[model samples]
Target: MATPGVFLISAFVFAFAAANIGGALSYTRPPPRQTLSVPLADDLDSNSPQQVHVSLVGEDKMRISWITEDRAPAIVEYGTSPGVYGSSAMGNTSSYKFITYKSGKIHDVVIGPLNPNTVYYYRCSLDSSRAFSFKTPPAQLPIKFAITADLGQSGWTNSTLQHIAASNYDVLLLPGDLSYADLLQPQWDSFGRLLEPLASQRPWMVTQGNHEIEKIPVIHPHAFTSYNARWHMPFEESVSDSNLYYSFDVASVHVVMLGSYTDFDPQSAQYAWLQADLGKVNRSRTPWLVVLIHAPWYNSNTAHQGEAESDNMRKLHGRVDL
Candidate 1:
């Protein structure tokens, strides 16, 4: 016969064993198989100039853009020296820090106040291997320009860019979604290289698109953050301190950019600034007026949902939207 203390100890040991066995059985089940996605770059390319395109800004201004995989600050070198006018335009450099982008900002450097009826030369670089050269539009009056939106770098999209180039427009006004950054970086890199031909020749005036917004935090560096760093737009020329929302005057046009992401009240800073800017514009200098913003005021789809916040803004333009 066992002593009382021994019996108690034996009973405790049995209970512990039972619990352990039960716990083990519960945890042995297999987990679900929903795998995470991986970025799709099996091969890496060298840091070379890609997506080179040109846009006509004004009579004296042009925008040049390119991309590199260097993951470093971008640099540009050119001057009026012999063998150097096609890429000429000594300006401050802009860096690309957004990882969300496979490439960097489109280096929309301005080569402007250029001599009328003159050609210029220039080169773009990352560090070891990002060198590219291109020419400028001939200075002339009644200059022609191409304008559009939703341009991309792949899938026979070259045809669209080719059409723009063939027009030989002095300027290109792209209001939204220049290249789809929402796709992976490779797509953006392709778009970068695709535009080189057009960007090198004319000034491409641009705004932003909904696709440009950054949803992830890690990619903030590349998120339209690169946009701010790369393009030297004359946003400051507008009453607003930001080019993301500002206005500039071309020969006979007053162009304004609105921050469609936020609520816009006539009393808002940008609204007040627009009022002042428009008030100041001499109708004689710029007779035409146009507004550029990402969101549409009204559309039929609504995508068809109802929300008070969206409804308030819809009142500005319309309830239905694009």
Candidate 2:
């Protein structure tokens, strides 16, 4: 069941819990990275497509995003059946140049008017890539979601993904700290490959966390350049001008993904958006309202002790129970 609350511990806590549950078996070796098999021609070597994933843009709509080593045309052929692409959508492509490196080209395509609860087949090509399939969210109530936070490309990640796959989640919500790339650009590539199994098949909605603040002193001092370029959330539909905070709907639930690392003060833009968003939520349509943030305003964790903004939020919204 999905509960409305704060996540004090990060993704690593889940990994450690799994280890404890397995007893001595927990000492077993971590699983190897999963890979998809494709023909040599489809691989396209350096220019091959990678890190392909999907995000829910709105009702009957989805966003497919991917990364490529070189600039190329981005197109997605998708339909309800394998090898029978009946529809196609063309979207924008961009690349980020930071410090001494220029990141790979990123592509995002939004496809829409899809039938709810149906499986869709897709093949993305920047150069050449394999086909993948995904099932849309159900039209009615009872949507299952899998959520994890602060994910880095570590050995424990393999096991965590196995558990998520077994759960049969309709969507995945990562609140923050994806890849933990810090400043190592290659780590982002590796992390994307690691998450393909779950992310490629379902919408992976995320919010920025502190770890994503890859600020290079005296060089590339801007924040969220990589995160913004890759994960294109549908903030525009919700009237939010920032990717750091946005909301989406699935089934009867309205999910609000917030950025704890960004400004959340009473006078900040995010706070204003938060108030307006919550005020407009039609409980008659979406009965459940769930909030996700990387850092809790009231967490007992010593590392974040004496946090202040959560108090402001509590005062702003008043005491209420889910």
Q: Please tell me which predicted candidate would have the highest lDDT against the true structure.
A: 2
lDDT of 1 by residue, 252-318 (tens): 5566666654447977777777778778866655555666666565533343233333333434335
lDDT of 2 by residue, 149-243 (tens): 86677666767788999998888989898987788776777777777767889889998888889987778889988889888898998889799
- Write down the lDDT of every candidate, Cα atoms only: 0.52, 0.77
TM-score of each: 0.62, 0.81
Model 2 gets an lDDT of 0.77
Model 2 weakest lDDT span, ten residues long: 14-23
Clashing pairs in 2: none
User: Where does the lowest 10-residue lDDT sum fall in candidate 1?
Assistant: 6-15
Candidate 2, residue 144: CA error in Å?
0.5
Off by over 4 Å in 1: 1-48, 53-82, 85-112, 125-141, 217-223, 230-232, 302-322
